[model samples]
Target: MAATTALDTLIDLTKEALDQAARLLAGERRTQQQVLQQLQTLNQYRLEYGQRLQEALQQGIDPASLLNYRAFLGSLDNAIERASQTLRQQQQKVDNSQRLWQEQHRKLNSYDTLVERRQQTVMLHASRAEQRASDELSARMSRNGAALLPPSDQSA
Candidate 1:
């Protein structure tokens, strides 16, 4: 019984740890999702700007004057595009981390369940053994009753 109680306590502790992990993962997932969305929007803007610059270049617009026209703007756009790619890579890493955390949580829960089952089994065996011992004692007493009976049969 004591062992069973101890196991239950350990199981509770394990569950608490699992819950905390879940909350942490949720917060991280939210942050990563926001970053991912921003990256997507930036990538789309980069594509649109590239097309606009290409159209201007085809019209015999002096590419040198285009520095004031769109060259500086193009540089800024390319920088943002590179930043978006970096963010995407970081978000992918975060996603992988979240998956690993979830898998670890599941494995811990499974182990906790196994511990509970074994504890219960141990308690059951202890109870059964106690009952069997009691039964054997009762049977022994019944068999010895005749020897302890009164001496009435000797007088008759």
Candidate 2:
């Protein structure tokens, strides 16, 4: 019973650890999703900007204006690249967090299983001990009852 109590304490600790890990993983996943959304928004803006530049070229824009448009487009491309890289890094973090949480969850489950098996074993031993005690009491009662019986009249 003492061991079972200790195991229960350990299981509670393990569950708390697992919950913490899961929360961390969830936060990482949320951050990764936000980064992905930012990346997509950047790409869409870049595409629109490129289309505008093409239209201006078709309308015979001035050289100075053309140079400015191209420079801005180049910066947009760089920004888009940076966002893509950030998204990738964020994804890696999410993946790592997920793995950590899974490990913690597995460990917690193993501890729970151990506690359940141990409890079952303790119950089985208790049951066997009770049976043995009952058997001994019955044997003692039978002997006492036999001694208390009246003697038979076989000499008559």
Candidate 3:
């Protein structure tokens, strides 16, 4: 019983740890998704700006205006690169969090299995003990009943 109690406590602790890991993993995934969305938005904006620059060139824009557009496009490109790097870093974090969650889940499962086995063992022992007691009681009652009867009646 004491062992079972200890195991139960351990199981509870493991479950809590697993829950925390799951939450962390979820948060990490959300952050990764947000980063990916931001990256995608940056790419789309860059593409549109490039298209606009091309249209302006075809229209024979002034040199100064062309330079400004080029400068702005360069800055946008830099921003996109940074966003891509950030997305990669965020993806790594998400992967690490996922592994941690999986490990915690496995630990919880192991503890649960142990607790289940312990409970089964205790139940089996209790059932065997009860059976033994019942058998003894039945034997005792038969002996007492036979003794209470006359010898001729007992034989019958």
Candidate 4:
């Protein structure tokens, strides 16, 4: 029982650690999602801007305006690239956190299993002891009852 208490405390600590890992994973995933959303918005804006640029060129746009559009689009591309890299890093962090949480959960489950087995063993021993005592009492009662019975009356 003392050992069980110790294991129980360990399990609780492990569970807490697991929970923290899960929360961190969630936060990482959220950050990754936000980055992806930003990437998507950038792409959409780039596409729309490109379409506008084509329309403007068809209407005889100035050289300076076209150069500016190209430079800005290039900058948008760079931003998208950086955001994608950040998203990938965040995803890796999320994966690592998930693995950590899984390990902690497994450890806690193992402790719980040990405690259950220990309790079962204790119960089995108690049951056997009770059975043995009951059997002894029954045997003694039988012997006493036999001794109190009347003796045989027939002569040899």
Candidate 5:
């Protein structure tokens, strides 16, 4: 019984840990998604700017204006690269969190199994003991009943 109580406590703690891990994983995933969205937006903006530059070149734009457009595109490219890197790092964090959650879940399952086995053992012992007591009572009743009966006569 003490063991069962201890296991129950451990199971509760493991469940809490598992829940916390799940929350962390969820947060990490959300951050990763946000990073991905930002990266996509950056890519789209860069594409649009590049198209504008192309149009300007086709329409005979001034050299200074062309340089400015090219410089801006370069900066946009850099930003996109950084965003991509951040997304990768965030994905790693999400993966780590998922693993942590899995481990905690496994621990909880182990504790539950232990508790179940302990209960089964206790129940089996109780059942055996009851059976023994019932058998003893039945044997005692039979012996007492035989002694109470009168002896049969030999001659008819």
Candidate 6:
């Protein structure tokens, strides 16, 4: 029946949507964790470099001619900090996307639930309709049988 086919299609679509949501959730979670780990690594590098710079200064390093040292350190700090910030932004974006996915998944589940409820209601109505039609047919058949019987051949 067309109704059966339509129901199957709806179920398939819902399953696909759920599958995509799960995949997106997994990928985004993985990416977020990776970014966080990268940030941690960058922080470690920055701290180590900072300590090295401090030790270099303490070792009578010429601050005047070592302008390149300061420049390199500054560049490293800026690059690392900027990368960390960008990663944080990306993490937030991923989190937002994940939230949207959750919302969409919830809405899809709600829609599926509504569809199932409607299907049950429709099946109930169909059962009642069939029962009514069967009853009408039975009544008509009984009437026909009674009329066809040899009622006129003998008085009750």
Models sorted by lDDT, best on top: 5, 4, 3, 2, 6, 1
Of the pair 1 and 4, which is ahead by TM-score? 4
Choose the strongest candidate by lDDT.
5
Q: What is the lDDT of residue 18 in candidate 1?
A: 69
User: Of 2 and 5, which scores higher on TM-score?
Assistant: 5
Model 5 misplaced stretches (Cα beyond 4 Å) = 154-156
Candidate 1 lDDT tens digits, 13-38: 76777677777777777777777776
- At residue 153, candidate 2 shows an lDDT of 93
Better of 2 and 4 by TM-score: 4
Ranking by TM-score: 4, 5, 3, 2, 6, 1
- Clash pairs detected, candidate 4: none
lDDT for position 96 in model 4: 91
Stretches of candidate 1 off by over 4 Å are 1-6, 62-65, 68-78, 81-89, 92-107, 130-156
Write model 5 residue lDDT over 1-156, tens digit each, in one string.
786678778888998899999999999999999999999999999999999999999999999999999999999999999999999899899999999999999998888788788889899999999999999999999999999999989898
For candidate 5, what is the TM-score?
0.91
Whole-model lDDT for model 4 versus the true structure? 0.90
- Model 6, 19-91: lDDT tens digits are 7777877887787788778778777877887787788878877857368677877877787788778787877
Query: What lDDT is obtained when candidate 2 is compared to the true structure?
Result: 0.89
Relative to the unseen true structure, what is the C-alpha lDDT of residue 39 in candidate 3, on a scale of 0 to 100? 84
**What's the lDDT for candidate 1?**
0.75
User: lDDT by residue for model 4 over 33-80, one digit each (tens)?
Assistant: 898899899989889888988999999889999999999989988998
**Pairs of colliding residues, candidate 5:** none
Pairs that collide in candidate 2 are: none
Determine the C-alpha RMSD for candidate 6 after optimal superposition of all C-alphas.
Answer: 5.4
Q: Global CA lDDT of candidate 6, please?
A: 0.79
RMSD values, in order shown? 5.3, 2.6, 2.6, 1.6, 1.5, 5.4
